[model samples]
Target chain A: MSFLAAASTNINPGLKAMGYGLSAIGPGIGVGIVFGQGVNAIARQPELTSTIRTNMLLGFAFSEALALIGLVAPFIYTS
Target chain B: MSFLAAASTNINPGLKAMGYGLSAIGPGIGVGIVFGQGVNAIARQPELTSTIRTNMLLGFAFSEALALIGLVAPFIYTS
Candidate 1:
């Protein structure tokens, strides 16, 4: 029982990292989609490339923010 | 027996945060797809930009709802 108690504290040092990893999963795919589609959009309408690229970047920023937050959220919850 | 209970109490404080991380994943990708395809649609049919944007936003909201739900879900489970 004492050993169990000792082990409990040490059991999940990597848990925070794992949380960040899981959190990043969504954003990673999301960024890929935004850029992939953005490229396709540009190919379809080269004249609107500027507008399309701007929108794509905006979407990228929003999606990437989630991953960044995930990186920070662990510290927030732990503390 | 008391020590076992004590150990259990101290375990996995970060579990809730991990729950949130897992939950965010699907919505993240979903949102990306919605916006990406929306942008592509707009480029393909520039005249329909307004309609495309409206639909894109609706899709984004629905997908974002899932992640927001995930953020709140851990508390629901814990309490």
Candidate 2:
């Protein structure tokens, strides 16, 4: 019983870390979609490239923030 | 001691959720900025509107992904 309990306890942190890693998946996919679309738009309208680029960067920044949260979650929870 | 420990553990989830929620703010603002600039670009150069719109949408999707990640973070952590 004691050994089982110890093993489970050790597994818990790994599970939690895996969760955090998995949580990042959504943001990763989303950001890619956003950029892909942004590029498509720019390609269609070369004249407005500057504006498109600016917006794309801004959106990219935001999407990246979510991953940052995922990275921080485990520390916050365990602490 | 047990009560304090339980209370802290209970509070931990909330904190994690809040962190996730806070993480979304960046993406929200980022997407808005992206759309705003995209619109402005389209307005300035009507001929390239189609291209600009497409790019904008793509960027928007990516930015929104971040929020999705935030939404999933809590569930992943707790599970």
Candidate 3:
């Protein structure tokens, strides 16, 4: 009985950590895609460099925020 | 016994996902800085814009690939 209780306690944290990890996947891919597209756009049109860069930064910020949200989710749910 | 096992299995995926998510941070910041610097460089010297832009995109792609690797990490670890 004691062993089972100890095991459960250990497993709970592990599962929670896993959930947090999985949540980051979308943001990770999202940031990469956004940056890749941004780079390509700039490469194609040097004249609109400033405009493109502003938009790219904005997109990057949002995507990074997604990853941050994922990191926080486990604590939010578990607590 | 069965419940504990099931819980651990469930948690494993979430942790893997979190690991993937955390992995994106460096690349995200790196791409942002690269683009920002690229833009500034172009703004300062319009004539060198073409060269600067090309180098910027190359840097961006390399940073982006880091995130791509993060996305693929889980499958690599689990398998």
* Highest-DockQ candidate: 1
Which tens-of-lDDT digit does each residue in B1-79 have in candidate 2?
1222221133455555555556566566656666766676666667776766776776677667666665665565543
Tens digit of per-residue lDDT, candidate 1, span B1-79: 4544443333344676677688779877987898898889989998888888888878887887887777666556554
Model 1 segments more than 4 A misplaced: A1-7, B1-9
lDDT of 3 at B29: 62
Tens-place lDDT digits, model 3, residues B1-79: 3433323334555565555556666666666667656655655566786788689778877876776676666666644
The best-first sequence of candidates by DockQ reads 1, 3, 2
In model 2, chain B matches the true chain B with a TM-score of 0.79
> What order do you get sorting by TM-score, best first?
1, 3, 2
Indicate the TM-score of model 3.
0.54
Q: A1-79, model 3: which lDDT tens digit per residue? A: 1334333334646665665565456556655666676676677667776766775675577557646655665454321
Writing each residue's lDDT as its tens digit, candidate 1 over A4-77 gives 44334454447777877898899899999999999999999999988788778867877777778777766656
Model 2 chain A: worst 10 consecutive residues (lDDT sum): A1-10
For model 2, the superposed segments whose C-alpha errors exceed 4 Å read A1-79, B1-9
Q: What is the DockQ score of candidate 2, to 2 decimals?
A: 0.09
Model 3: residue A21 alpha-carbon error in angstroms: 8.8
Scored by lDDT, the top model is 1
